[model samples]
Target chain A: MTTPVLEARQLIKRFGGLVATDNLSMTVNPGELHAVIGPNGAGKTTLIGQLTGAIRPDGGDIFLHGRRITHMPTFRRSRLGLARSFQITSVFSEMTVLENVALAVQAHSGHSFRFWKPALRDPALREAAEQALDFIGLAPRRDEQVGNLSHGEQRQLEMAMALATKPRILLLDEPMAGMSQEETARMVAILGPLKKSVPILLIEHDMDAVFALADRISVLVYGRIIASGSPDAIRINPEVKAAYLGDDDA
Target chain B: MSMNRATAANMVLIALLLALPPLAGLMDGEFYIILVSRALILAIAAVSLNFILGFGGMVSFGQAAFIGIGAYVVGAGTMHAFEDGIEWLGNGYTQLALTVLFSAVAATVIGAISLRTKGVYFIMITLAFGQMLYFVAVGLEIYGGDDGLSLYQRSEMPGLPDLSDDRVLYYFSLGVLLLFLYLSHRVLHSRFGKVLTGCRLNEQRMAALGFPTYRYRLVAFVIAGVMTGIAGFLLANQTDFISPAMMHWTRSGDLIIMIVLGGIGTVFGPVYGALAFLLLEEFLSGIPVTIAGYRIGEYWQLIFGPVLILIILYARGGIYGFLQPRSNGK
Candidate 1:
């Protein structure tokens, strides 16, 4: 099998007395969309935090493209093509939409120590930023401040920023948390074509979007992965249903 | 449209500043020129503080420490020269360059430690460092301690106009202020500025996006320190004296007030702030104050305090913000 784009082995994280992420192990193969589904406070976000280097694991290891990156800083991980979107929409609100994406492009383009030339006037960076905005259908509002964008639009901009970095893998934490049904559909459409190019590790509570897009799904409960397999197999897995789905058709 | 208005206002301010020395000569004589030059020097210091405080959201209360560092470099350099009976230490230009270098190095060390904390802790720690430097200045018996060191002679700069003349010194200070302003403008619009602003807005987000924000912030902090230190070099030349008073905590507080009064983040806001603050102090001090017919002598702060409070309460964007068209978006 092809090497997984991202791999976590026995990841552990604790917050005081509670183990937030307990011995969690997961992988996303190249070109695959792997969804991690769990109830609220089930350590889904914590797991993503560890994967993206925001939260250091108490024990275990993480690898990116078969290279160890367990202790890498968040920025280094991003430079290595491990991009992530926050569960909370985190865009530079004071900056324009294009500026927000341009910053992401600038992050990976080269050292940002260039202090003389105006960043907005840089042709290459501008072109890439414009492309990312165009891809996300936010081109019309490119000059508008990100703070003024709707919650859904801000989510799209967050994704645009992640994509602007040209990551080999994407880690999205609840990208559809506050979106309306139509917005969620639009987001799903946006992610559907993206999976062919970059592997995704999506932590989501929305089962419909997860089942539709996830090539494989991992059911996490109480910080442990109770089951991991194709969506159909997880749908029929009795253990997963009892532990998480609760007899409901997920 | 707002950007154009802001640019026009800035241009007008610059034109006035450039025209000041010649205009002051025609009107009042040397005193006015010296007063305005002092204002300009302090403006540079305020602008430098704005980089870390306004733009980077690092409310460094110890900025006066950098200014003091610059002044002390000049003081120490001159003291060594006087003791050795040398006319000047390779000219004033070399002294100024040394001051800048020392200030940058000092800022790097202070910033590395201060940037580790956030919000109020950062402010307090920086204030502590500033006070520490102030005490050190006071303890330096070789440099006159609290009595302060008096420069027997201003450092000489060959090939350029003599700085001994008040008019020449005023113009030189104005030139340096404008140059630093231009450089700062370029930096604010650059990629480095973007990252600095990004870190200010959301450091975690910037870090997640592949930016080593700590290093970026430290670089910015050092740049600000060096710029302010240059202001200090000018301050020493303007007053011909250096003392621990230069780095006093109240002096740093005054710098913070200058930035806030002008409009914290705007490029030329601090300049306007320094001008307003110094002019207000000058105007207020000249007038006698009375409370309910009881005379209060030279307590200008009583009136200044109320007026500043009113300005802060009503004008959230500061005096610069008050001057701009209200519809202009941030």
Candidate 2:
């Protein structure tokens, strides 16, 4: 009944002569977990980049809550409650865990030019960081440097950082990437509760997590959305089976 | 990681540095306060380079330009102020500080423009700008052309103990170095510094999380320039001379070598590096024996390079890397 939280209509991206993204379109409603599955080099990462304002689409518009945000910079998009976890585990390796989340909190709060008073003493920032860390069960290791975190814990820290931005639409590019089976299960559990609160656009290769977590599924092959429906209907779509989802459908 | 511990650490460090010079005198006269002053001043300059190379991960080869700019500004300003041997700036030190400020401003403007490019491009562009400035100094017919401008007197610190005495100047330089170190440490510890570190570590991640990483990097570049500019100020006063020689690319290389030689990421490491570098320079020149009887004086840095390579190859993180044993790929 309400406008989708995010909408991309006829998005087209071309690099040199190669159309990395071709007429791709999707919409995520309020508090919906929409999973986008595609083969490697199918322009999935490129689509995410365009959505988060890293790359510009040659054509089409991206709308956030019915307002066009086609040409906004990445920081502005983030300020507007759009957050994305990088596919690669990118973090301030030299900084402590608290400092990492504290930065995200600082970003969401206001300008950080407050240089005289010590920032580490700001209880508000610390509390906000702790809340995010608590949500991801990373509160125990808050004092440790991020460089010392385990692969799974680092991924959790990434999600915690994104959550600290207080985003409305969370763009997750392969959250389970490089995770062992145990870590993957933990991520699924973590995303389960978050799925109820935020509209998540997930690009995942893990079929089990997608089937368990995604409210709706979109099959992208060769940069085109070939099928979109409930989990069962998407499973039976012949073209989706041929292009993708076939191997994972056990 | 509690705020209390961080504050305590800073307090202790500041206390230790402030008390160090007087204690050095207690040891013996060999700690010539003038040499201490020179060391402290160079450390301040090296700290500025540390901000760019260590924290921001930007390897700038133009810091010497900032140093030269600061030096020449003071030298030229003093000369112009004393036209036909007249009293210029009334008091020389105030004039020198203003010159340093001007150099800081120049560095900021230059850094803001050059930071737009990344990686090797950034290095080359900064080097290009430094070369241009170097040539500008070389081309200046007035103010001693190739020969450096000399001040009749080192800038005097007004309202303080007469800094003309060697020990007094050493103490003053000590105070300045400690102040710069504390300020630098504070800046790096602040939220501003944390975000800058974030930008350096993972710029894409910082951007995606709503930071204009480019703006942050530019701000960092400017801050480093300004800091280096101040060091340049002290240097001119210390040497009582200014020349195009200070701005050479090889000088920039020396600064890089200092930071890398000591350790890149460690805050205190560059200070140690500067001490080691200068001491090595003085010591090697003073060495009684030379292999094949060739002077190893200017070529000391050649030895320093191989030593740095050994450190880099053996200890990836430099001395701190050896001490801390950071868990990479964890």
Q: Pick the lDDT winner.
A: 1
Instruction: Please list all clashing residue pairs in model 2, or write none if there are none.
Output: none
DockQ of model 2 vs. true complex:
0.52
Error of 2 at B96 (Å): 4.8
Instruction: For all candidates, state DockQ relative to the true structure.
Output: 0.83, 0.52
- Model 2, residue A177: distance off in Å is 2.7
lDDT (Cα, tens digit) per residue for candidate 2, span B286-324: 656566877677477677667768987997765545544
Q: A171-211, model 1: which lDDT tens digit per residue? A: 99999999999999999998988999999999888889999
TM-score of only chain B in every candidate structure: 0.94, 0.86
TM-score per candidate, chains pooled: 0.96, 0.91
Scanning candidate 1 chain B in windows of ten residues, the lowest lDDT window is: B321-330
Which candidate tops TM-score?
1
B303 in model 2: Cα distance from truth in Å?
Answer: 3.2
